[model samples]
Target chain A: MIPNLIFILVFLFASVLFYFKVRTIAHDINLGKPVEIRDNRLMRWMHMLKVAIGQSKMISRPVAATMHIFVYVGFIIVNIEMLEILVDGVSGSHRFFSFLGGLYPVLISAFEVFGIAVVTGCIIFLSRRNIIRLKRFWSSEMTLWPRSDANIILITEILLMSAILTMNATDGILQARSNQHYPVVGSFLLSGFLQPLFSGLPDSTLIFIERFCWWFHITGVLAFLNYIPYSKHFHVFLSFPNVYYSKLEPQGKIAHMPSITKEIKVMLSGNIDYNAEGSAGEIGQFGSKDCRDFTWKVLMDSYTCTECGRCTSSCPANITGKKLSPRKVVMDMRDRLEYLGRNIRKHGKEFKDDKSLLDLVTSEELWACTTCNACAIECPVNIDPVAMIIEMRRYLVMEKAAAPAELNAIFSNIENNGAPWQFSNEDRLLWADNLEIKTN
Target chain B: MDRKKIEIPVMADLFARGKKPEFLFWVGCAGAFDDRYKKVVKAFTKILVHLDVSFAVLGKEESCTGDPARRAGNEMLYQMQALRNIEIFNAYEVKKIITICPHCYNIFRNEYPDLGGKYEVVSYVQLLNAKLEEGKLKLSSELFSGISVTYHDPCYLGRANNIFDEPRLILNSLTGNFVEMRRNRRFALCCGAGGAQMFKEAEKGDKEVFIERTEDALRTGAKIIATACPFCMTMLTDGIKYKNREEEIKNWDIAELIAQSLDL
Candidate 1:
């Protein structure tokens, strides 16, 4: 009864916490532009299934891929044990696993071995993250909390599984001594090792230890669920929608530049009078300087990043000694949005200062990008960093009139001569005239 | 200036009169303007005529497709120029527009749609391949006597439009000995001429991207460097000159090869 009550209280508390965190993230993402769908419904579903469930993104990296597969499989299979614990705690009878017949014990044993393998695999990943520090893993922008939280969660999981083994061993010993011929005594392989410690303990003492472990396991699961929405673990939920809604157009296609004349006409002629109301200037030009400048889809992308470092690792700019890391750009945008949300909540509609977020990303980092889609192609979460970079460049070029001198000269030449070359337009047909081919 | 000029027959009313020509040859800006490219364009036209494909030229009515302007962020000018070209195309009722230049092909096929223009666009290699398959074009026994060649995949044709096979197929069918550059197909390196860089000087970097790409082509140790795009041909030719490798390595458009190989 006590164990059941503890499990219910912890589950309810965690559920409430998760609800609020998810709400805040959803609200902020909807504050930007709406997502445009280009792919057919069937194609979108196939992509989602392949990328989200198949772990296509994670498997791109071989070593990490293998480790993740084991952990994912173990977590899914072990969920049945969680249900059993919940039921047994309420009824005071651990019959769930036993009801499956002769094969149930074998299945449990197989899962037990796989759980140990998952624990081992996780340990390897933790060591790699801290010691080997692979370039992709090192540059990941995962929140500081999630990294340490993962380690704690793994250790606690190992402990809970160990406790389960110990309780089973104790029960086997007690039953053997009481002449209760149990069919599963042969399956409890750890009984001989645990006999020295719990052979003299009373059956009641053994039962108390089992109940205590059951409560710890349930509480740990609840805590993880509650913390998921607030941590980098939020990617688990966001990754699906992010991949499904990913841009289907060719990577080189730039966003359609909005008509400048139409916007100006609307501002001047509309009854609402945006210019008169002081919301816009005489020559209206829309550009994003911070997180809010991005569309809602871009904002969602920022939060959906798993910080897997696939993007940064594949980035030519980063590989060639440039300061721009596409992953960092997305993370920085997310951080700024969160910061601005806090300010808006406190100051309401009058809040204005975004100088800090603007300062976070430099023009050098922005210009260093070659607009290559390598980062986007490599990202497991389908975050289009190239689009974000180009969007920022558009703002820099069109609104601020700030760009590299050479690029500026090129644009000027194109505007004047209809070519990037400085030569006279009269010489344009010189190549044709020199050819042996007859003119029309 | 005493070179034998190849005559390109003019037929502005061919499409309007419902005459089904073998091919509608598109003479791009480079083909019409660049000195070296003009010879190659003439050669390409002669080869198509030899293949018995009745072709027509746009003559003085042809204008810039505005690809350079669009790529350089001058969208307004691109729209203006594109609209003008669309009017010409519509007037001629051009159905299948074929060009030796990958840039012109890309603009006509991809960018023209955004400006409300539509036409069936094909590259020179694609048209030539069809002729070869139909046995209209045949390879000569004289194989240039052991001259090795390597094909450079232009960004527009290879990456932008996923056209890597047709050029290679034509080259392989023409010459038994053909090698590939290290970076080919989708992973091919840019010739630094893309995104309107051909019209402007390259920005300061450790090395010129075009030169680097040309070096990759030269590293294959082939006697000749072949390309389908006029921009790439011009850029690679200049790169060879810059490296003082003009004496060692030569550049040729695919059309020039077909023209030279023809029994005519």
Candidate 2:
């Protein structure tokens, strides 16, 4: 009864903490401009299934995809065992699902098999991060915290699987000794290997070890759940909705800003009074200046980014050693959103900070992007870093009037002469002039 | 070279004569201004005149599609240009447009519809491939018999719109010597000419993007680098010149290659 009470208290505390943190994240994302997804609903759902559930995009890199599949599938399937663990903890029982006769052992044996796969995958992943040191994992933006964050998640997964396997191991030994609590169930494939280690121990010690593992496993699962809001590991859940809400238009298409559209329409309709100061108070907000300026989908994208660096690796500018790293751009968005989100919570939504997302993702990094869509296409989670960069550029050019001098010339040339160069529109058919040479 | 006269129809002139062409030839800004890309426009027009595909150029009335303006974060200018172009297309009652440049094709096909300009926009490669498959166009293999050819997929054409197979199929039909660069199709590297990069110097980097892509084409040992977009054509042409491989490597647009193969 005491153990069950302790379990309830721990579970409730974790749930409450997770709920509050997740609410903050949701609140922060909601602060962004609400985007209207006017795409086909079926297509969106299909893409979500293919990208998030199927993980279809990860298949490009065979080795990493293969290991990732083992880890992803194994972790997901083993979490089913979490259901049984929850039941056992609440009732202060051991293997409560064992009443299913032979089926319980089959179910547990399957989970144990997957648990082994999870452990193996995690070890290989750890080696890839630490020993082999894949270049993507060690890019300039992948600071100490991010590297350690990845390691912590992998180690935690391995440790959690260990606890489950160890718990089953001790439970099997107790069942073998015909203990009152642990009913006689057939051995699991994974945990059965370790039964002999504890077989020599006394029943009292075996019970203690089994209970300790059960307590530790439940507590660790709760801790991991709460850690997700602070970690990149939250992608496991956010990826689904992020993929669903991602744009359906051609990758090259940049979404038009309706606010700008309205203003332009008034000017085009000759509604602008040139003499009047041009909406001076509203001049500050044009493109994305900070976290709040990003659309809801972009904010969600920041949260969903796993920071795997596939986008950066495939980026042309990044490949040529340019300042732009798409992964870093997305990471900065999340960091700024978190910083701003915290401030908003403490000082209300209207709190204005002098620091913008551009301060972190410099205009230099944003300008280096070619708007090629390579980064967007390469993102495994369907995050469009290009969209964020373009939004920031819009802020720089439209609101700040701070485009590069060359581009400013290009803009005026296009505006004045109907092309990006100094040539007149009358010179458009000069190519036809050469064809006329045949007549002479 | 054509000493023979071929009449290039203008939309204003054709419509003035009460004759509507089947397709509007969108002579993009690069197709008009760049000296090298101007040849692409002429070659493509030659093919259209040869095959007797009814197409008309907008001539002086044509304007920029604002692709560069939008990409450079000048949406106000982009919208202004887009609105002007859309009005001209509407005035001509244009039903279909054949774009020589992928950037023009991309803007016309994808972005223009949002600004109330919708037409059956087709890239030259797509149009050429369609003609080839329909048995309307034939290539004499003797023209490119000894020359090994490789294709550089333009970012606008390949990754943005998935117009990969059409260019490849056209090249394959023309010559068995056709080869692929290391990063072809979706994995294609940019030619350092996108997003207003052509108008400005690239940010500090170890190697130029065009140089990197040029190495990919050079590594293939293919003599002729076939391109579809004018921006890509200019970038690769400069890349070849920079490496002093211009004599060995000829950067020709696919339209130019097709025109040559047809002996037009």
Candidate 3:
């Protein structure tokens, strides 16, 4: 009864804290303008299932993807055990789901297997980040916080998995001793292998170990849940929604500005409305200067980046030693959005932070992009860094008129000659002037 | 000045008689103005005429498709140009378009619909593949029987549109000797001309994208580089020139290869 009471109080505290943190994140993402991505429900759901739930794009690097899928699947399947643990915690019932006589062994064994797999996956990933020292994890964007954040998540997961297996191990031994209220639950296939270590412990010591593991596992889960909102690990939850709302148009198409389209329509109709009040959401600037200027989907995309650096590794500009790192583009946007989120929490919704995304993402990085979409293709979670780069580039070019000189020259040519070249429209026929072929 | 000139029918000339051709041969800015790509326009036109496919040119009525403008973030200019072109296309009631340039093909096929301009658009490679499949065109295997040719995938046409097989199928059916670069089809490298980079010099980099892509092409050990997009043509051509492989390596549009290998 005492254990149950303590469990309830701690769980309530963690729940309340987690609720407010999630609310803060949602409020911050909502600061951006609404976008129409909710259409095509069936298609969106299928995309989410394939890209996020299935981890379809992760296998571009076969070995890393295979290891990641084990942890990803383990993370999901182990949560069923988490549900049973929560029930046991609340009711003070040991082995709460032990009623399924035949299935109980199978379920506990599967949980043990998954727990071991999670530990193994976490260890391999931790070594890759620290020991092997893969260049991707050490890219310029991954400073101390990101580096430590990745390590912290891995270390925390290893500890949580250890607690779960240890709990199962100690519980199995206690059940054999005919302890009161300790039912003879089925053997945990993987954790049973560890029973020898607790073979001869006293009843009071065994009980202490079991209770400690139980508390540690539950508290660790809650802490991990709250930690997700602050780290790139947030993608574990956001990837599904992000993939669902991915831009469904042909990959080559860039959406034209609707406000500009309306203005052009008004101009074509020869209606003189220069003095009239602009329409709602008049779009004061031509493109994104800050996170708010971007669409809600883009803001969501900023939060979904996994910082795996696959996007950066596949980038042509990065390969060619250009200033652009698509991964950095997403990370910088996420950092700025986090800043805005914090400011709004401290102040109010209308809080103005003089800082902009441009300060974090340079014009050099923006211009260096070839808009190749390789980064988008390589991203395991469907985060589109190129789209954000282009959006910011749109701001740099349209608002500041700060396009590179060659682009400025081409823009003038397009205005004057109706082409990117300096030649006139009459010269458009020059190539065909001496060709002997039927045109009509 | 000592070259033979051909008579081309303008859309206005045909529209005055209340006539509409089956396809508007969209001679894009590059195909119309770039000297190197003029041969591609001529070659594709010859193939269309050889197959007796009814097509007409907009001639002077056609302007830039504003692809570079749109990519360069001059959305206003892109919209204006797109709107004007749509008016002309709608006025002529154009039903279909074929172009040798992927930039025009991409903008016309993917983007124009958003601006209230919608029409069936196909690149010359797709049309050639269709023509070959339909038996409207035939190739003489003897033309390129012994010549080794490798096809470079234009990013806009291949990756952007999933058009890998059409050009390859045509090249394989025409040249019996067609090889692939290490990075071909969806994974193909950009020729560095995309995103309006063609109109501007490349940003500061260790090496040009085209030069690296050219190195990929050279690794394939093929003498003839068959490309579909004029932008790739220019970039790869410059790459070959940069490497001083002009005497050994050459770039030809797929249409030119098909036209050369035709039974006609």
Each prediction's Cα RMSD?
Answer: 5.9, 2.5, 2.7
Give all candidates' CA lDDT scores: 0.69, 0.88, 0.85
Tell me, by lDDT, which candidate is best.
2
lDDT of 3 by residue, A41-146 (tens): 9998988889899888887788789779878888889989888888888997878889989799899899778888889899999999999999889878889999
What is the C-alpha lDDT profile of model 2 across A70-105, one tens digit per residue?
Answer: 899998999888888889789877778888989988
Candidate achieving the largest DockQ: 2
Local lDDT at B181 for model 3: 93
lDDT of 1 by residue, B11-58 (tens): 565655676565567776677667688878778867775665777877
Top TM-score prediction, candidate number? 2
1 versus 3: better DockQ goes to? 3
Once fitted onto the true fold, the runs of candidate 3 whose alpha carbons sit more than 4 angstroms away are: A268-270, A275-283, A437-440, B1-6, B140-142, B146-148
* Greater-TM-score candidate between 2 and 3: 2
Task: List the candidates' TM-scores in order.
Answer: 0.77, 0.96, 0.95
List pairs with backbone clashes in candidate 3: none
Off by over 4 Å in 1: A36-39, A55-68, A71-97, A106-131, A139-217, A230-233, A258-284, A356-358, A423-429, A434-440, B1-4, B8-88, B91-112, B123-161, B167-264
Chain A only: TM-score of every candidate?
0.83, 0.94, 0.95
Ranked by TM-score, top first: 2, 3, 1
